[model samples]
Target: MQEEAYHIPVLLAECLEALQIDPAGTYVDCTFGGGGHSRAILDKLGPDGRLVAFDQDADAAQNLPDDPRVLFVPHNFRHLQRFLRLHKINSVNGVLADLGVSSHQFDEAERGFSIRFDADLDMRMDARSERTAAQLLQTYSEQQLHKLFEQYGEVTNARTLAKTIVTLRATMPMQTIQQFKAAIQGVVKGNPNKYLAQVFQALRIEVNDEMGALKQLLEQLPEVLVQGGRAAIITFHSLEDRLVKQFFKQGSFEPEEDHPFENKKQVSLLKVITKKPIVPTMEEQKRNSRSRSAKLRVAERI
Candidate 1:
């Protein structure tokens, strides 16, 4: 896919400003989806500067620029620390992660990320991973599905939806997008499109374990970023935004037992750069409808 059409970097200028690019320092782009943000970061980096970019999607590798200064890692950002050490890098001058699902992924009918298409119910960002949305739906207990829909998707009739899924799975197959949608038709609440979108969002997040991966990345920030270095995260969902906001402001995330870092001294090691998330300008939202929900939060490692 062409970089231009693959994904438009949301809040482009704001993200660059947040990084305060030091031409000779090293940087990290945790989600090198379309390479849009990475390419822009590269423009600000001098020849001696380095950029370590990461993405699990094989499609992303196709967009890698022909530059020796960049070290691209074909893995999820959750493994940020592991890969950084593997490459003999201890700290970075700045870090960025745009946590939005790329337009390319949604537009590609076969990926099953969008509600518009009828395809295999697979929402894996990395094809190498075995879990798929179909597997979750077929296997999860009714209570588990209820919790997923309620917590992740905020589906209005989540409990009912879960019950319906359990009741239907016994007699019908829910192996594809069309099949699942048809199966859940009787219980969809409010707007059909919006309801299905929420349902899909929950499944996608669970199948990929997005929140888990994000927490891992956040926990690594204090260790991987140098003092005064910046972390600019762009989150599309409120839940993801809240996690970043809390981690940047408090250096802690939800669920103490599930915390990614063992060294959680309950003290924040970063300074919040944006008092509130910087949202896309009206002009940008007009140009790209997908960017309307985007929120950019920047913080400096203290």
Candidate 2:
């Protein structure tokens, strides 16, 4: 199958430019959704250059290119350091991670990522994972649900929604998207579609441990890259972007208040290349709606 057919590469040109690719230098694509960015990186590499791509989703393996230069790792990017060592690579010249769900996952009805679909509430990016959205909804405490919806989804009536879910689940099991939607219909504010999307986003993040994986990936950047190596990450939402921005500036996930001593450190691990994140152009946003929320941040190893 063609790469674009799986998931159109958002901010393709911008990501390639941000990497500052060296034809003979090794690179990594942390989220190889459809091999789109991997293919572009391969096109720029010399015979000796190597590219290691990671994706936890089993469906992604079908789109892998038959190129010896590319090494596709069928695991999450959170294990980046371990995998690189397994390949006998100490450091890479660049790393690119496009975080969040791919268009392919959202379009696939059985994945239950889209609100448009009435499939079972299974949102595990890696099918091997046991937890599903249904399981999360059924198990999480009201307080836990409230925090997830508020923090991850930014849902306006998160507390009320959580309460509603807890009350409804006793009599109505939310095993499918339609059942889950009907359960929360009363608390949905403003636009139903927008509200449901945010709710679904929160559930998906919780089930897949998206934030946890991203934190792990960020923590390993300094160890994974050589001096002057570039890391270009494209985040689809503010939470992910904020973490990337803070890590690039502070070399740690903790807030400046939490790590007051960080300011006095002699050397920082990463130097923020893009002072502000690079956003998609109007034309690009129009062409691909998913690119609208994407913010690309680039950093160089110091």
Candidate 3:
């Protein structure tokens, strides 16, 4: 199990440069998949520098580097502040989170994170999670499915797809990948591969509560990092990219409807570093197709 094979860190050099690593500064790798970025951060750190690496998926534990300067926490980055305080740290100099599923999760057939697989409809990033993708199909109402497909997957035929699932699941079993794909075969629109991938992406997002966790992590950034400390986040989809972009630009997930502070002004907490999101180069994308969708945005805590 090589580190690169587990997960090829996307925009590695860009992330390192974004962090602007200081030798004795403390940092956090919110999603320490393969420890790729963390390892690079360590290379620039002096002996006194510390890195707090967090990963909810147990699989990533194996890829963690054996270094005294690194402290591995087996928890989701949503608990970033708690974990940092528990370790007697007040603030970090920089934070990095690559919010993409690792290659290892997709490569393993049993993970159900890939569209190419025919395993159980279980796409839990953290295996300890009780809900599975199959359960969502079995339990979600038609409207719920429609909204999920429409908003999360942006499926053009979301309503029809939801109706189809609601109609079929009563008689047909979609407890596995093969069963689900076959069940929805007739309704697939556009490219078969791309359509199915979108559906799977929606399921994975809901099952793992990824967006919720990300919001929690972002909200903690201002409190956990020192002034001028950088936070570099790499997002894979537009939904995530938009969230990061908005937070960086305005320092809040604003413009929400009927919320308590919908119209209230929020003092900006972050100063945008990258005027535009950084995307992978052609050479990197050619080397790893998965990096194509990645967009890196950075901001400094104000």
Off by over 4 Å in 2: 258-267
Q: Lowest summed lDDT over 10 consecutive residues: which window, candidate 3?
A: 255-264
TM-score of each: 0.96, 0.97, 0.96
Lowest-lDDT window of 10 residues in candidate 1?
254-263
Q: Which segments of candidate 1 are over 4 A away from where they belong?
A: 254-265
Q: Write the per-residue lDDT of candidate 2 for residues 19-113, one digit (tens) a residue.
A: 98999999999999898899999999999999999999999999988899989899999999999999999999999999958889999999999
Better of 1 and 2 by lDDT: 1
Residue pairs with backbone overlap in model 2: none
- Cα lDDT of model 3 by residue, 82-145, tens digit: 9899999999999999999999999999999898878999999898889999999999999999
Query: Deviation in angstroms for 290 in model 2?
Result: 0.9
**All candidates' lDDT scores?**
0.94, 0.92, 0.93
Which parts of model 3 have CA positions greater than 4 angstroms off? 256-264
